[model samples]
Target: MIARFDYIAAVILFSIGLYALVVKPNLIKKLIGLNIIETSVYLFLIASGDVRLGIYTNQWAASNVIDNPQRAVQGLEPMINPIPSALVLTAIVVSVCVTAIALSVVVKLYQHYGTLDAREIASLKG
Candidate 1:
């Protein structure tokens, strides 16, 4: 039986991140929530590669992969599909951009209101 601890942990972390995003009124804390969610997303993506899609083939991957099959004879891609990996890389870069922008906005908001709390932000002078 394949232990799905990674899946369970990722789900739990995602829930925490979602809760933090919803319950936190501080802009910085919300950004932290965003980071948590991003981390969960990356974890999920990595996990997908490891999950068995179950359509095994015997085509050869690289020579080394051919040399070291967990099984024998039949060919397979050996390496999980790289599509998710590439997408995850893109997602990471986009998440970084989002974080940078969020931080910039927080700084501006702080300058304007001298506070980082969501409710306090609206209380500041225009």
Candidate 2:
């Protein structure tokens, strides 16, 4: 049940991001969509790696959060995994670099054409 719910949410997020990416006409809007897509994938990664038990989310507040040993809740029996987290960290940096480069290109394009809309940019292109 938990798995199903998480997957459903992930799918929804990805779908919305995709829609935004495809349906938007402005370059900045498209960039925002790309960011949305990136964030959705990251969220999906973390959720997909969440520990579970018998259809239950086993995640709990750590002692660091509550600061009460007696009332502290144990972490998920199996800590989902760590590889995804590491990969996501790398992906985040890469995405940031990509976005920066893209923005630079877009700025140059705007300077040459003075428009941010994809349709307008295409018309201005020669």
Candidate 3:
């Protein structure tokens, strides 16, 4: 439980965001919730990629080869995975673009309907 605190926090954040996205009637609130969900996903990905007490690849190699020659011949050293972090970075950029588009749509909707409430906009349309 203690070791997996990040996972727990991510779950909680996701739940809160999901609640806001589903239960809120305001479009802006929904966008905020969506952002929260994205953030939680980012946190989860980063945490999943983390290596406890692990050294960087270069540092590990240098330390083994230079500081401890015998350790170099033993095997590969523990290092944090880079793939998840890289994927998260890509997701963040995509998320920003998506948020920008969503906000623009929301702005248009507000301008047309004079309100940001989803129900109000629907009623106005009908």
Candidate 4:
């Protein structure tokens, strides 16, 4: 059986991030934790969809991979699915946008309350 240590590492990273997000009182720390969780998800996706060359042969010889386009669709063990990698790319872009928006919100919150603590901010509101 193949070892799934990568998955374990990703899970660990995700757990750490989750702990930080839940335990940290500072908004910045929560944001950092969110990013860490995102990193872990990326790692998981990449690890799950890992593709090693030469393991799976196409209908044609390995040498023809570059030359014959048809060989790509007709493979022996099947080529690695590109969907996960593509999804990861989209996720990365979305994550960056989310982080940027979140940081901007954090800045505004800090400016309004002069503090970065979530508890303090909440108390200040009411």
Pairs of residues clashing in candidate 4: none
Q: If candidate 1 were superposed on the true structure by all CA atoms, what would the RMSD be?
A: 5.3
Candidate 2, residues 84-113: lDDT per residue as tens digits?
Answer: 888899999999998999899989988888
Model 3 lDDT, residue 55, Cα: 38
Decoy 1 TM-score against native: 0.76
Deviation from native of the Cα of residue 72 in model 4, angstroms: 5.3
Report lDDT per candidate: 0.78, 0.74, 0.84, 0.84
TM-score of each: 0.76, 0.75, 0.81, 0.78
Q: Supply the TM-score for candidate 3.
A: 0.81
- For every candidate in turn, the CA RMSD to the true structure comes to 5.3, 4.8, 5.4, 3.9
Candidate 3 or 4, higher TM-score? 3
Which residue pairs collide, candidate 1? 57-75, 58-74, 58-75, 59-75
Model 4 error, position 56 (Å):
12
For 20-96, candidate 1 gives per-residue lDDT tens digits of 99899998998999899999989988888763434343333223444456543354425566788999999999999
Model 4, 1-126: lDDT tens per residue?
Answer: 236777888999999999999999999999999999999999999888876555455532345444555766677333567888999999999999999999999999888889998888877763
lDDT of 4 at 82: 83
